[model samples]
Target: MSQSTESTTESNPFTRPGFIVAAAMVVALVAVGIVIFLLPKGQSSAEPAPASSSTVTASPSASSDGGKSICGLPGSAETTLGTAPQSKWELVGRIATPTDPKTFGPGESDSSGFRTCFAHSPTGALYAAMNIVALGSSGSTDLEQKLADKLLVPGAGRDAAMRQAAADSRTTGSSTPIQVRGFLIKSYTPGEANIDLAFETDKGALGRTTLSMRWMDGDWKVKPADDGTTYMGATQIRDLSGLILWSGV
Candidate 1:
């Protein structure tokens, strides 16, 4: 399972036209890099099935906001709070359309300024939380740890898995922020949401997978099952100007 900041080069030799640069990167790094596998299709075993491509489209505009000029807050009566992740992770701003075409959202392009406590909608809130979890930090007070505590389901095993992934030493790359392309919300309720997110690493490693989130403590928290293939383990990137290549989901 791979999770981290998003990226995919434009003029990269490994990239091809009409293809997602990030997706191409994932294909290229499948051997040495991490993998973001799809949800098991009712298979009780933790072993991942296989990687397959999915079709994703950009978000469409909606009058749901009713002229309320704020970030794409979902239809909910909640307040969002701004937070800095231990000052270790950098915010490249929020993006629109998520890169993938299968996800749904309000048609907008600016994917920046995510809040911790209030995201208005499940998609926005969960996306922000996922970004926080995917990012890696080396500071004494790791921001990822804080987010894991707040966003993930409370458990020793969960915490340990998250910590282990964040501290992985196999990755030798840049520390640049991730770039989210698109997301698919499988199911969303007032209390819980299931999401499939697609992201690319600065090194051109692309990943997409599903996550389970539940509203707790007045906020959305990722409650990944004790499966080892939840998301890609966190790692550091050495460069951001790398190639962006993608074939399919």
Candidate 2:
């Protein structure tokens, strides 16, 4: 499951046009299916799943309080925006994931095989979004189901994801790995956040997607789209011009 992030001038599989298309498709399906699996029957490459009501307005108490506990985890008072935040990269379930112990979490884990406990700050939300995508696309069916059960908000979207996981039996394909290259925080409140994430393929193809996060129970969980996928508004990008570039790769 370990692969190099280096670029090569020689003929390589990642540089091929076919691999780029597959990689783009894999990015689109990050929260719905494994990166190496094909789209569900009848889902078209040109047609995206309907967008979900993932955006939420900030509440009156949305401001950051460094001394207060937002979700039973340590709180961060930092409210700075429009800059790349700090992160450390480590392999989580076979995919490179970002982590910040002081802020963002998976600060705690249990026998259920799910990572939890993240800070309730903007940076924390950013890290949570990245980790969720990485873990969901880690190519493990059981892990995917566990994430859907534990880290996704309880809703029709979660129910659909649970059903899809139970029914998933597709063989892995030759899709290349997708990496998080940059991000933008579309909006945030203490209770909810809408984050835009930038993804890149090994061949340098770029795409963007949005994730809605809600502070639930004592941790941050992804709020899936109405269709049961973890992300929405996925589209190919020409470059990383407008993003605050950040990556663990």
Runs in model 1 deviating more than 4 A are 1-115, 133-141, 162-178, 201-205, 227-249
Worst 10 residues of 2 by lDDT: 13-22
TM-scores for the candidates: 0.44, 0.70
CA deviation > 4 Å runs, candidate 2: 1-72, 78-80, 110-113, 170-174
Which lDDT tens digits does candidate 1 get at residues 1-249? 232222322222122111012223443344334454433355343332232343222133332333221433334432221221111223322222122112212223322322354343544444444444333222212443444454567776466645644553332222333355444555665566666555564555545545666665544556654532234322222221121221122
Cand. 2 Cα-lDDT: 0.60
Per-residue lDDT tens digits of candidate 2, residues 138-187? 45566667877888899888887778666664323224557877777888
Error of 2 at 87 (Å): 1.5
Q: Alpha-carbon error at 244 in model 2, in Å? A: 0.5
